[model samples]
Target: MSNSANHIISVSDLKKIYIRGSEHIHAVDGITLDVNQGDYTAFVGPSGSGKTTLLHLLGCLDNPSAGVLTVEGKAVYDKGKFMNERELTKLRRDLFGYVFQKFYLIPTLTVKENILLPFAFYRKAEADKTADRLADLLGLSHRLSHLPKELSGGEMQRVAIARALINKPRILLADEPTGNLDSKRSEEISDIFCKLNREEGLTIILVTHNHALAESAGKMVELKDGKLI
Candidate 1:
């Protein structure tokens, strides 16, 4: 439990249950954690341990079956109820940026186009300037005009990172960000994450099996059977 004023995210007894016919699967069960502003936290566990599910809940990508989730001192979910979808969507768009294991980039869209896709939902002042700065920060400035198919695995992931940052989200949620990369490429991504947290002051929460990537974070949270261990 964290009581600091800077705690950006807080979860208490969070649980996610899925029903498959008569069987109930507890993907995330009774987990509690706190994430401070600009904190780099890694969630590590086995394949069925609910790491990704937890991340989804935190990012507002999924709803929890039970729990209290507080973001930035506001209650998003409490006592079996959640914030309305409109507000949740705003939180997802303005407060959290997400990156997944798969690049999820459109093959036909150039890197710049892919990075700018989020702008279709909400307008940003000087969107191009913001994208350009993110591209430079993520080392994607030179490859912005190339298609996803033309880039290496590392470059593609960098573009994804830039896209996630274009909204200037306060938190970055990544699930198995380096799962598809070679060791060298994975190392590069790890370094970029470090720079994002340390230099750019982005709060990063990631779920990963990669030991080196996990070690780079300031905090390590281990999960097992959907519970913190």
Candidate 2:
């Protein structure tokens, strides 16, 4: 990875509480963590153990009820002149790239257009070159004309990965990225992630329930009751 060992995401005494009627549910309780730059880490937990909730907070999709989160050395929402909507949107657009279980490509668009879609909102002169390079590396040079509906599941997910990397994000956040694929496809995707981590210095955070699958990660963090175990 980057190998700088500098912290990219730091969470301090983070807590998330949900109010249901009169009862308070503590989804995350005083969880503090640091994710180094270019880390390839996996988060594992049982259902309702707050793995997803914690990921949302770390990814800046949600605000924590208490404690502090600093992303890229800036204080998170509303703390010390914290990020406004414009800044948050910019951060999301410029810093984090997301991959989910579903390959959410537009059904009507061909693979090339789908990969080039995000650049339409924010263009860089090098965008096309980057897309072309990733396409070659991902073995999708031949599928450029295929539509999302016309591709197989693994093919679709590979397109999704290419789309996510188009911006060359600071962190790649994946929530069970291989959840929709078969075992062979899962292994293939895992190898791609490992390649990203090693070759491109991508910081990847994955949340998965499969222990056998999670071991592929360099560092594995287990969550129990929303706290690291």
Candidate 3:
């Protein structure tokens, strides 16, 4: 368990190395960090600097090669030991929400259906109320019935954001969320993130190459060559 009662994520000397033939790739080199509850932290670095890798490890989407990673007081990874797929799945579904660079919305599904897809996976009752609230928050309420193909880039991103929030996750892990958006849309998305962090006290860890976008977070951690700077 993390010593700090309010720490939602605690990482100590964490690493993720990949074996590419005879070569070793350190995607996430030794890193020690803490993210408190309701924190809005951003990881900024160039491509291949391990920003996304660190986010994946923290979100329980990937296991660490070494060291300890605890979330909400539970050790998700320690040394070579890691939470099994089943455990990780539960953690992701129950405590974490993810948004990727690409919107990843289902082309055939309506905005509402896409947002409610997680409920189907968990076999839980559909959270229509939560979905509606999030849709309104993200300005997607008017496009609930539209398909992904019918919406604009900003609208699609809004739908993605709403979908991620439908589960009411404790932590939101976003990887270059505004990467595909125009400057105006990116600013809108940034504002939405700040609003969520401020109003709902959502814990957010964002990975971005854009320093301006990253500056919106409460704390910024820069990485270079897979090591924090």
TM-scores across all candidates? Answer: 0.96, 0.91, 0.94
Measured with C-alpha atoms, the lDDT of residue 10 in candidate 2 is 86
Pairs in steric clash, model 1? none
- Candidate 2 residues 62-159, lDDT tens each? 87888888888877843324567787888888888888889999999999888888874445658888888888878799999988988888889989
- Per TM-score, the best of the predicted structures is 1
RMSD of 3: 2.2
In model 2, which residue pairs have backbone atoms overlapping below 3 Å? Answer: none
Point out where model 2 deviates above 4 Å.
Answer: 1-5, 77-81, 120-125
Clashes of each: 0, 0, 0
Tens-place lDDT digits, model 3, residues 126-166: 58877888889998888899899999898888888888887
Ranked candidates, highest TM-score first? 1, 3, 2
In lDDT terms, how accurate is model 1?
0.92
CA-only RMSD, every prediction:
1.5, 2.6, 2.2
* Top lDDT model: 1
**Better TM-score candidate (2, 3):** 3
